[model samples]
Target: MKHQKELYKEAMTVLKATSRTFFIPITFLEKELKTTVGTAYLCMRAIDEIEDDEKLPNTIKAELLHATSQLLLKPFDRNAYLKLLEPYRHQLPEVTLRLSDWLALCPEGIRNTVASSTSEMADGMAKWASKGWHIQTKEDLDEYTYYVAGLVGTMLSDIWLWGAGIKTDRELAIGYGRGLQAVNILRNQSEDKERGVQFIPDGWTRNDLFQYAEENLAKADQYNKSISKRSILMFCKIPLALAHKTLDTMRKGNNKMTRKEVEQTVEEITSE
Candidate 1:
């Protein structure tokens, strides 16, 4: 058998490179797992790249995900999406390079699991983009976030459960994922607006959103504290702070969410 240590090291190298590159704090979590935390991070990182990528038209993005998923059913062809990413090669995270190497060496089972899940995440994204307009209500936002991020919550909970010391508070952990994503949506209101995406409900205006943001931040704090894993806690904390800041700004009638606010939030959380 190939060494588990080697697999883990590759995974963590990818994890470290991906998280820092993407401004995520999730990697501070490696110590809690008995097995491949590295693979988990790499898999999740790839998902993050897709979700955060603002370049492609919605349909193309959906097609790319469909292709990625289909390729995963077989062996992953590294070159398949390599070209798509090449123009922005300098922008690729150091972790993705390590992830490529790790993908080659990973246990078939791990690779299969990660690959399959990535496909599902992509499929869900595709379905969301084209058909989302059919969803004409606030209830739609709940389902949409669940498909995009709440599912990440479930996936993450499963990962933590597979590891040691997870202390699974199933509802609580998933709440962190859902709440965190919601906070990001709230914070990125302007950017999303530019893309013609509206995450919050039409019924909820600025003041109502402020109250909702405050509510979610509190949920994040509660969930992070309820969970035993320090890594999960660290990951949860950033959005909690962002929600906190956004809520505060809303109180002052600061309607615009700027890059400066995001940078300030990032700095504040990392320093802690």
Candidate 2:
């Protein structure tokens, strides 16, 4: 078995390569929080890879997602687990292949949190994938976002409280997660359409989606304001600031933030 430091180095490598946006705030976390949150992010990213692979049949994706969730709960079985995951292995990013390693490195409480949240996300993904990734109404959109994102908010809140003693408003934290995810949906609207995944309800224009995202962001602002610790506040603020900036840029028809812009935003948040 790899030592904790080696495992953490591997996790950070995967995190930085796969999700630069998240790496920023995660880096701001204190040591234990950093490892736990990084592990959680990598765990979710693993299942997300399976769910998002366009080449896989929905049935196969559902099976793999379910299996991945199950593996996280049981003791690690290298041979059996890798065999089960092998077919989808090539399709997923390298970090996802190290899921067991990530699980092994998590502190017990955080591991349980990661396992439960990942299981819930996998179950939700399987259900939605079976239904053809459709969002037919406002309720459907909310449910979909909750599955893909809001549960993440709740998981993060649990982690924050456990790791740092920071109590977060679960409802507003869910809104924070939904706001960031809504921004992603809006930014990737065309790409999602190309993949036959329609997150937007019928009769909802871009403006409607924007309105929904902004309202959630307003709540996210409240969620951020509730954090008192400097490290935790900065950790929360970096992403929330970027989400707002991304939404603004999206409304102006420029959805991507330049590296300089991202750096400036992080610098501003960390300095405050």
lDDT scores of the candidates, listed in order = 0.59, 0.86
Tell me the TM-score of each prediction against the true structure: 0.68, 0.96
> What TM value does model 1 have?
0.68
lDDT string, candidate 1, 239-261, tens digits: 56765666666567774447777
Q: For residues 12-51, write the lDDT of model 2, one tens digit per residue.
A: 9889999999998888788999999889988888888888
How many collisions between residues are there in candidate 1?
1
Off by over 4 Å in 1: 1-27, 31-39, 73-113, 132-135, 215-218, 229-242, 253-272
Residue 225 of model 2 has an lDDT of 81
Worst window of 10 by summed lDDT in candidate 1: 31-40
